[model samples]
Target: MIQTHRKKAGFQHAGLLLMLLPGVVFVFIFSYIPLYGILLAFKNYNYSMGIWGSPWAGLEHFRTFLTNPDFFRLMRNTLLLNIYSLLFYFPMPIVLAILLYEVRGRFFKRFVQTVSYVPHFLSTVAIVTLMGVLLSPESGIVNLILKSTGAEPIYFMAKPEWFRTLYIGSTIWQNAGFSAIIYLAALSSIDTEQYDAAYIDGASRLQRIRYISLPGIGPTIIIMLLLRLGDLLELGFEKAFLMQNPLTYDTSDVVSTYVYRVGLMGGEFSYATAVGIFNMVLSLILIGIFNQISRKASSVSLW
Candidate 1:
């Protein structure tokens, strides 16, 4: 009987492993296989000779990127944009999730959730195009309304000062509802008995939220903030590139966009790769510092 049980358990474990096989294969193919490209960062890559055969450049590329005049500008833009995102975009989902939790009607809640998250599925190109159409100086409905109100038409996408506002606001709109999914899941797991106890003690709705609800989701908030910190320097290329024009480069230009222009377009592969490594290192350092503070303060951390 013992021998039979061991054999049955082994088969069950094997079946579970089989279910994970596809995901493991996918990660290996898409993620790990591409890691070989990191070697190009240290070499003056030549297409004719290939990556391995390319002449070694050592820290020459790194030095060049560090010494470049545009380096600080690109870094500043990237950091500031991410900072703005944290300040403005981060709180939005938490607030949305709390609001969603308070909704009393099932159908209205479901409808609102669906509508809010649907924009997340739209392509970035589509979102940028929609912004262009909706904010056009002369023809856009927004500008038309402004003009009718005796105000001057504003070219939102063309102005450097408005770039951060548009970018961050659009990001919040596109992502807040989708991001609330995790918080909602976390909130749902809060014990009902805690709320019951708070209510029986004659606590107000806000008091219950302060004492029970916020504490329940506190760890989730910290983890999400840490994750954001991990990607501090990785402002995505596509949306910024799509929204960017020659006029807005002062504010909109970020490391990823600069990398595309200088590395891919200009064929400075080693230098661009060096810049990427620097950004990665910087992000790592930031996340490490923040994680340490969080761990000390709250006893929760990614590590």
Candidate 2:
């Protein structure tokens, strides 16, 4: 009987491995295979010569990028943009989730959730285009309202100072509902007995939330934060690129967008590759640091 049970367990494990095989192969092909391209960072790539045939460029690409006049500007812009998002945009979803959990009416709750989530499904091009139409200086509703109120028309997208606000605000609007889903999932796992017991004990809503709900989700919050902090420098490339124009370039040019121009547009493949490697390394370091901090502070992390 024991032998039969062990054989059955072995078969179950084998089935699980079979289920996982496709995902492992997918990562190996799509993710691990791409590591070979990192070599382009150190080589002077040529179309005729191909990657393998390209001559070594040593650290010349890195040197040039470091010495460029725009180096500081690009670095500063990228760092600040992400930092600002971390500060302003990160907490929004948590707040949204908390509010949603407290929402009483089913219809209103569903309505709010649906409205918030719809933007997440919209394509970036569509969102940006809609933004353009809404913010158009000539005949947009915003300008019309301003004109009616006897205020001067403001070109939001054209102003460098407003770029960060626009970008971060749009991010909050677009992803807050989707981001809230994780927190909501965490909320569902909390024991309802705790809430019922707290209520019977005459605990106020705020006190219950503080003592029960927050503590229950504390580990989850820490894990999510660590995951986010790991990619501190990886701002959304497509949205940033779409939002960028001559006026907003000062604020909007990030590492990814600059890499696109260098590698694809400017044809400095080696230099672009170097920049990408730098970004990946920086992201790795930040993730490590945040993970360590999470482990130390809360004994919870994403290892």
Candidate 3:
């Protein structure tokens, strides 16, 4: 009887494994398989030699990346960009969602949300082009206004000082409303009874929001923050690369753009791969640190 029970348990475990087959296969193919390519970071890669045949270079690639003159500038730019993004992009969505949640008129709230989210659907190329046209030094709307006021036209895209502002501002404008949808969903899940109690206790609108709504969605916020921390090093290459030029390189050149230049343009595959691995390890460290902090302080963690 015991042998029969064990056989039945084994069959059940096999059934469960079959149910997970697709997901397991997907991760194995896409994630684990690609990890093998990380070996290129330590090798002198050549087109003729291929990945496996490339000669090992020990820590040469890493040494070159770390000692390069541009290393500090690239690291500083990337770090500051992400820090600014975290300061601005991280909180705006939550604030927007809270404001929307407080609105009494459902139609007006939806209309505002719909209009705001429209920017997120626009192609990045189209958005950048529009920005250039609007901020052009000569005939652009912003410059035209400046000219009317007898102030000089600011060459925003070309100026190093403006790059971080433009990039982070554009991201906020494009993503805030769309990103708020998840927060809004979290807000919707809050218990209506809690709000009713607060109201009965003579709590003001702001008070109820402060004590009830904010705390209610705190876990969602913590989770999103953890995820963002995990992606701290991964700024979008398309937008930054398109907007950057030699003049703005001081502020705009980041890890992704550097990797693209070395790997695709300069044909320095090993150096680029090494830099990429460095970024990944840095990101992993930041994620682990923040996850630990979140678990300790807020009792919310992805793991």
In TM-score terms, which candidate is top? Answer: 1
- Give the CA lDDT, 0 to 100, for residue 5 in model 1: 100
lDDT of 3 by residue, 1-303 (tens): 999999999997997889899999999999999999899998999889999998999889999989999999998998899889999889999999999999999899989999889999998998899889999999899999999999999999999999999999999999999999999999999999999999999999999989999999999999998999788887889999989999999899999999999898999888898999999999999999999999998789998
- Relative to the true structure, candidate 1 reaches a TM of 0.95
Give the winner by TM-score: 2 or 3. 2
User: Model 1: per-residue lDDT, tens digit, 1-303?
Assistant: 999999999998998899999999999999999889888889999999999999998888889888999888998899899999999999999989988997889999999999989999999999999999999998999999999999999999999999999999999999999999999999999998988888899998889878888899999999999999889899989999999998999999999999899899999887889888888888899899999999999999999
Total clashes in model 1, counting residue pairs 3 or more apart in sequence or in different chains? 0
How big is the positional error of residue 244 in model 3, measured in Å on the Cα after superposition?
0.9
lDDT for 117 (candidate 2): 89
How would the candidate models be sorted by TM-score, starting from the highest? 1, 2, 3
Model 2 scores worst on lDDT over the 10 consecutive residues at: 227-236
Instruction: Give lDDT tens digits, candidate 2, residues 1-303.
Output: 999999999997998899999999999999999999999988999989999999999888888888988888888898898888889888888888888887899999999999988999999999888888888888889998999999999888798998898898888989999999988888889999999999999999889888988888888888878878887778788999998898888888988999999789999888999998887898999999989888898889888
The CA lDDT at 108 in model 1 is 94
lDDT of 1 at 128: 94
The TM-score of candidate 3 is 0.92
Candidate 3, pairs of clashing residues: none
Q: Please list all clashing residue pairs in model 2, or write none if there are none.
A: none
Model 1: colliding residue pairs: none
